[model samples]
Target chain A: MMKIDVSLSKRLGDFDWQARFSAEGGQLGVFGPSGSGKSTLMNLLAGLLKPDSGHIRLDGSPIFESASSINLPPEKRRIGVVFQHAHLFPHMGVRRNLLYGFRRTPANERRIDTNDLIEALNLGPLLDRGVKRLSGGERQRVALGRTLLACPRLILMDEPLTGLDEGLKYQIIPYLKQVFNRFEIPYIFISHSLNEMRLMTDRVLEFAQGEMTGEVSSELLARRGMGTGQGGYSNLMEMGRLREDDGLYIYRWGGQEICLSNGGDQDTGMFEIMSKDITLFKRHPEASSARNMLQCRVVKVFEAGNRIGVELDCHGQRLMSQVVGSAVRDLGLEPGSAIIAVIKASAFRRLY
Target chain B: MFEFSPTDWQAISLSAQVAITATAVSLPFGFMAAYLLVFSRLPGKALLDSLINLPLVLPPVVVGYLLLLSLGSEGWLGAMLAKVGIRIIFTWKAAVIASMVVGFPLLVRSIRIGMEQIDDHLIQASRTLGAHWHDTLLSVILPLSGRAILAGASLMFARSLGEFGATIILAGNIPGVTQTIPLAIYDYTSTPGGDRMALGLCLVSIVLSFGVLVLNEGLVRRFRKGVK
Candidate 1:
């Protein structure tokens, strides 16, 4: 477990930022748009930048405090950073890059075994290859593996997946999830992507301008973001593996079999469907173009901006769907109202 | 066809010795200067930059004269070294010093270019990964700047081989002891009917310098391949 408590302020040119917050261990996220001082916050936490007059602590041990003029260098502070672009040493091979931090750390402080990290990150084949030879996804995995080998108390990722293309970005998520699952090290993920926030972080600290505007859970942040009208509320579902049939992948999701197109036969069966893509019918249509229809009852009706987000319970599984206020009135989307949600086979997008 | 004398052989050997010594001895200092220029936040950096580059802009003869003042017997640095019974004037060592001073700016410039191209995040990543500053320098910065260092060393070595104005002023044109290729060529050119020997030595100078340039080019290519 890890805990972070920081109250810091720094003025860069015309920008003034003051942030104070304390968070306990978990997949915490720093969510903000560009130029919002998120990188500055990361630098301060990693000891890469100094806070003008403030204190920063991890697990109750102070790493920086202006009152006593105590500022530990980044090396002294057991914090690791995975940058947006995988800054693997160009001169070293994958093995050496992975072992760099491990070698520098003392024997006693090292708790993570090298072999386990390599295996968890699936870096075995790429070990002998130079970092430049690896693809974009491969480089990121090596960067993460390298940082994990150092056994840092907390990892601060500054948009680690930003530069990767859409397919490559999500392709690395499972490796990241596997490493974090295999190792219990706490990490603070920083990104501007709300989809990434929902997938990776349980709690999020929102930043706007130069100050931290609010603290929110990832669920609330996702719900609050539904008002943007850009593909409202994405529902993440874990579909159990099944055999492919008739050019479509069949999977078990929420105690119901669902058909998905463009879902390749990868071991990772996680998929996401946008709330806007899910159409609701008061009664099952005798014939429809959409492939999967699941009978659901409205568990809650929450208001997100002008749109209404209908939370549904189907076979003890939760799914979110959004509709206009008029549609909600017409469909009678109240708690305990039975409705069938129609989803096209093409709507299911694989997460990883 | 040319007839070479034993003194010409001495000049040839001495030229290589002086150039090699100057390049080898100046490498560490050059690397540090490049590091300072590229990375350090020290005050008066601009002044240090100008001072190191002064010899590049100044005439070599003027550089030799200034160095003569600094290392002369009556000068402060020379006086301090004189207490240790180490005399450096009018010797092959003086030629080495002259070449080093003249060739330093080129070395530093090449290395600074390489160092500047390195991403700031790589260094930051190293520090956060539990590496000390020096550790990062040796492990990260050093290897990344390696190709540039080789290129710089080769440039300086070639420059030293053809060094004429400063070598003439500082080390003098003694036939065997202090005379190098350039000094010897000067002597041959001045003597009546010695143009053949001067032309022969000029060929040697071209071959030596061209060899260094080719070797440097090959090394840079290999380093780039290794990085890739």
Candidate 2:
């Protein structure tokens, strides 16, 4: 299992950001508010920036140790990063950008095959094209290919999807998933959106004011959101087979199907539905405008401040709904209660 | 109609050689100075920055006077070179040196602007891709700054071609030897009934400057196309 331990501090403008984190194993999702030291942590991990005072270690190697005055440069640390802007060398073609790190890797140490990555990332047509000619989605894919070719022990992605719209984000998510599934190396994915982080990884590190508040499984965070009512919950369902129905697109997941207003013939991917957008009714509302109504059994009902948090099991897939305490009592919602969860087809936001 | 004298031809050829030599020799140093000023965290950086730009702010004759004091036959650098049996004063080499010193700041200023305009993230990306500083400099910074370097070299070359104050003071206007186009033009203008010769050389200077500007633009556009 790969491991990381970092404790660093720096002053930014008027605030002191004390960044600290420790992680082990699977891809870690770093979720935080703006100016919460997420990017600082990434830079520190990648050796782009040194900490004021602390040590950073990866898999037992000392990348940075302030007390010992040991600081390995970014190149020496074998870390790869995909910045928010992609930062592809504008002077280089796609092929050169991808091969830049490949050439730098020692022959015996190189694990990635250039042809395989090019094929996997579908970079064949783009190899000879200049970086400026690529679309945003294509640029991200090329950036991913470039970073992967480096054969880094750790990778850090800083808000890779922040600027992308919903459609473009879905287009890029599979490539990201392919990296984690195919490569054994550990990586930290940073983003401010929980929806984006949820689709990327289960283990998330939430930051606030330059410190990590907690590291929890995505499910637990959603559950916490359900309990608090302040932190709204969302469910990510891994979409399976796909088909077209009239002008709408139908997606199969967990023995049930969800319909989308559009996106027919698109590749299968994951999508998120906000828990607040889902309403629980004791019986099907025959006159509702919501396009999706799944018959589900109430898994649990818990107190959420002045609200009621309902966890439901629909065709073996978990979904959440929040209702006021008065409504919960009026609907007689409780554990093992049967209900129809209503959601709009427009609410099915694809998670690329 | 535009027949030139042997002296005029010799001065034209000497000026071209001196400008090319000055630009060529100073290119690497100017690049390094610009890179350091833009990227390095050296102590007294402000002072270093000011010192690199001193030539642009100071008068050319003043620069030549200082060069004479520091590099004259009896001066410290000249004494050291003299110990090695090398003399630079009142030579064509001195003309090249004078041109280089006067034009150094222009080269540095243009290159520094280019370096400053580069996105730092590109450098960071290269580092994370396992390229060391030298590799990054060669593979990224230099290529991205190609246009600006060309602009700077063109400016320096043009400046060197027209260099008169320093070249006359240090190298002297010796015909067919230390004399360049500008020096020879000065000589022709000062002599009685030499207006035609002076005007011919003046036309040559304008044409040379114009040609350099056109060539620089073409080269910069080609480099940018290759880059994109």
Candidate 3:
């Protein structure tokens, strides 16, 4: 397994960031709000910035260490980086720019073929054209080809698609996927958009307030969560609503309560309960059909918006039910009424 | 109805020889100094920059006086070099040296700006491809800055051709030997009934200046087109 173990702490004017994380060989996406220290972390990894105090190791090889006094310059790091702006040299033709790195590599260590790169990037027609003549997408393609030709151990992409339009972003995302999959080299891709992260990465490291929260599987947030009232009552009740006091949310069911620790998103206090965990009942069933049933009145009903958000009220608490709109109307639910809310014991998960 | 003078032709040849020699001798030094100024974080950088540009601000005659103090026969370097049988005072070589001193600052400044304009990421890209500093400079930096180098060369050549004050001080005005076009024109204008000769040399100087300007423009245009 190719592993990256690094800890970087830096101070830029008034803002400060001290990030630490490790990942095995895979497509690791770094997601955060703007200026959340994503680019700074990448710069540190690429040897462009030296950490105030820490060590960076790639597969046990020391790239940087403050104690040992080992700090490799950017040129010696064997890390390839593609900037947001495709910084191709304007004076050189496309072929010359692409071959610049390839020509510098020692013959014995050079693994990539020049022709293969040209064909793969569809650069034959552009080879003779100067870089200033290339379109934005074309420039990025050449930049990617240039980075690939270098045979880097790790690739760092700093918002490679930030300025492109939606149509162009969609067009280039697939090509990026193909390149990443073909090389199978470890990549730390920086993106602010959650949708792009979902489509492009397998693992995501979230940054907020200058610290890495943790790595999360991309599948965790891929689909919308089933709200409170729509899904089976057992699941909804088990995944409790956000409590205002102490900022801790708890789901209680079947003599068990799970507490959720805060993981940075304090604003827009939203949490997701799984659809499969909710147990729906027709009436106010007593005696134990499920744990934690609320006498909720149906508020507004619509096609659960992704078949998941059915709004309802349970004892002055506004709740969302993830269910088919047909189910809401089938029960003849109307404003200001009473029904039983059944929540499963298992679907209560505390998001971090 | 054509009147041609052998002395006029001799002055033209001498000026051409001095300009060529000045440019040739100073080209490598200009490149090195310019590269250092752009890429190095050395101490006294601002002082060095001001020192290089001193000739452009000071009168050319003052520069000649300084050069003479250091290079003339009883002077520090001149006396030491005399021991090796190398005499530069009042010779054509001394004229070339005078031209070079005046022309160098422009060359270095232009080339240094060109080197600064190169996108630093391009150099980093070369390094990731396993290229060391030397290879990166050779394959990337030099080619990218070729137009700037050309522009600098043209300016240096033009400035060297027009150099008069320093050249006259270090190398005495001698027709067909050390005297260049500018000096020859001055020589003719001072003498009685030499107005036509002075006018001919003036026209030659104007033509040379115009040619260099056109060549510089053409090079810049071609480079811009290549970039596009």
- The runs of at least 3 residues in candidate 1 whose Cα sits more than 4 Å from the true structure, single-residue gaps closed, are A242-248, A262-268, B217-228
Interface RMSD of structure candidate 2 (Å): 0.5
True contacts kept of each: 0.88, 0.90, 0.69
Q: lDDT tens digits, residues B1-228, model 1? A: 766789999999999999999999999999999999999988999999999999999999999888788888998888999999988888899999999999999999988877887889999999999999999999999999999899899989999998888878888888888899988898889999899999999988889989999998887787667545
Best candidate (score: TM-score): 1
A26-121: candidate 2 lDDT, tens digit per residue:
689988889888998888788887678888888887888988999998899998898898889988899899998989988887887888788878
Tens digits of lDDT, candidate 1, A158-257: 9999989997798788888878877888999999998888788888999999999989999888888888859999989888768788988888886798
lDDT of 2 by residue, B1-228 (tens): 567999889999999999999999999999999999999989989999899889888888999988988789879999999999988889999999999999999999988877887889999999999999999999999988988899899989999999998888889889999999988888888999888989999999999999998987787677557544
Q: How far is A274's C-alpha from truth in model 2 (Å)?
A: 2.8
Better of 1 and 2 by TM-score: 1
- Candidate 3 Cα outliers beyond 4 Å, as residue runs: A114-129, A209-214, A219-352, B1-4, B221-228
List model 3 lDDT by residue over B1-228, tens digit each: 224488778888888888888988998888878877887778988898898889988899999999999998889999999999999979999999999999999989878877887777777666665677777677777887788789888888999888999999999898778888889889889999888878878888999989998998888777666544
Q: Pick the candidate with the highest DockQ.
A: 2
Among all windows of 10 consecutive residues in model 3 chain A, the one with the lowest summed lDDT is A229-238
| Candidates' C-alpha lDDT | 0.90, 0.85, 0.74
Q: TM-scores for chain A, candidates in order?
A: 0.97, 0.91, 0.65
Q: Is the docking of candidate 3 incorrect, acceptable, medium or high quality?
A: medium
Is model 1 an incorrect, acceptable, medium or high docking prediction?
high
